[model samples]
Target: MKILQITPFFFPSIGGIENYVYNLSTNLSNKEHKITILTVNTENVQKEEIISEKVSVYRCSLNFRYHKGLISIEFIKRILSANDYDIYHVHIPFPLGLEIAVVASKIHKIPLVVTHHGEYTKGNVFFSLISSIYSKICRNISLKYVDWILFLTSSYSVSLRLNKKIRKKIKIIKTGVDIQRFSATNDGAILRKKYGFTANDKIVLFVGSLSIYNRYKGVDYLIRALHEIRSVNNSVKLLIVGEGKLVSELKELAKELKLEKEVIFATSVSDEELPYCYAMCDVFALPSISGPESFGIVLLEAMASGKPVIASGLPGVNDVVKDGITGYLVEPKNVKQLSQRILKIIKDVKLGKKFGRNSQRVIIEEYQWANIVEEFEELYNNAMCKNGDGGT
Candidate 1:
């Protein structure tokens, strides 16, 4: 099968959707499927590169940015000209990409599978309203033409208010994690010592971008919760493991809360070292406050590292973390509850270990990338069969 994956961003650009496409493409390539990734040149890296024998990536020149989305005329042209693809698998929240994919699918008579990651949300009301209107128009049109719609969770599908007709084309396909790279055996002691954290210090980890567009991630709420937790537990330290425009603001907030010593900002963490960052933490938290955070991929990474996790009780996120079993789910933006949950895991070593064990079990049983790729392969084959192209 020759598959073309269209996404807004790819490798060297860190985010859930980028990671998902990278993993899925590579895994499919490994199975002898010719995989080509079509993405924007966000990092200004090579325009075209070969990742593996069967995998290739072509990046389009980025024209401009509109809120969270990238606009690229070259991308649309490439999609229009693209030929001989067995499947057009596009990851969305990328309105322009979806629109073009819909056109290309019709022009070429190809099967278009859209993975709706989430909706676009702006920080301000006026832009939010405009974005909502634009999204609805694109979504309705894409739904009519696309062969299938892949959602991260059933709850996320519900959040979109997809009608029965649209729901018939929907398939629930959760994101996956690399269990081998993020394993319990990975030593966290080296990372803790490098960061000047004492063995007795309780580390609370938060991993995600801090860009203005991702304000809904609620990193500020997590920082405030850390301050509340530090009021009583001095040994607790917050380790943030991502860089973005809001880094300085978050640092300033830490200083204002007198948590300069208690908060560790690891903005330069590489992909190779991410597992250690998770392993070093006593608990992982994702306190997203809105619908844009459809699913928490970092939570799965933490679970794969055998760490206890805490996330917002958002639709998609709540479905990922089993409350009180794998980890606790606190209400979005609830600082007190978030702090309490973190404190619970930090204070009770046995309970934390139990949760960590359960987390590892869940990842092994459900979220492995290898297994997830097989499901994708099956979906693609079925799509091919429906088109009378026969399964590869």
Candidate 2:
């Protein structure tokens, strides 16, 4: 099968969607399927990251959106003539590339699959009316052109409420991670020694964009939760990984709470270094405060690292974190619940290990990249068959 993924973001830009697409292509490449990707070219980066013999990357600019005006006529022409890919799998949020895929499906006579990341929720009072209209158009057009709708979480049902038509095409598929990398790195001793994280010091990890606008990834909730966590365990320290607009503000907020030392920030980290951070942590928390955090990829990463997770009970995140077993789930933005859950994991090492092992079990049994790639391959084949394209 020849599969192509289109997204507005990719490597060097960290987030759930970027991780999903990278894992998808890598896993698919390992499956011996011909897989390729087209993403926004940052600094015009072009380097083939060979996941296997079967995968290749083609990077190009929709540079206008990052700097200039609207989508250019050239952008459409560029993608149409890009390459010969059997099926087009597009990850969405950006209305620009999505609109092109809608047209490309018709123009190229290829099967198109659009995965819904989740719908936008907040808007200013004056723009709310325009936002609503834009959302409806996006849903209607996306559903109409897409041969299949890939859902990261069953909770996508809420986003589907506005467009019941897309439900018929929906397939529940989880975003996957490299379980071996995480499980193998959890010796916990070296990382502990390296980071100066003491035995009694409870380690908490928060990874994602720290942007004020993108704070929906929920560093704030994690900060608020710390007030209670520190009360129970003074040695508790948070290691926040990622850089964004909200860094300064979040740092200020931590200082205001007299937690400047308690909450330590890591600007940006390489993937190789992530294992130690994950291995050393007592708990992995993603308090993402957004409607569109379709899935907490890091929860799986934490589980892979043999650590329990504490995450918002949002549909996408809930899909990854099995409440009471794999990790505890708290209501979104509830600082008290978030704090209580953290304390539970910190105080009870048995419970933490139990949940961490359970999380690992879930990853090995269901969320491994190998298993996820198989599902995606089947979806691609079915799409090609429907389009009368050459597919086995």
Name the top lDDT candidate: 1
Best by TM-score: 1
Note the Cα lDDT for every prediction shown.
Answer: 0.89, 0.77
lDDT of 2: 0.77
Candidate 1 lDDT tens digits, 1-392: 99999999898888889888988888888788999999999999999999989989999999998677688999989999987899999998787888999889888878889898888767578767878887767677678778789998988788886667778899998778888899999999999999999989999999998877788899889999999998889899999998999898899999999988888899999878989999899999999999999998899999999999999999889889999999999998899999999999999999999999999999998887788888999999888787777878
Q: Give candidate 1 misplaced runs (Cα > 4 Å).
A: none
Clashing residue pairs in candidate 2 (N, C-alpha, C atoms within 3 angstroms): 211-246, 212-246
lDDT by residue for model 2 over 90-147, one digit each (tens)?
Answer: 8876567787877788888889988878655454554456556766776576677689
For model 1, what is the error of residue 66's alpha carbon versus the real structure, in angstroms, after optimal superposition? 1.8
TM-score of each: 0.98, 0.92
For candidate 2, the C-alpha RMSD (Å) to the true structure equals 2.5
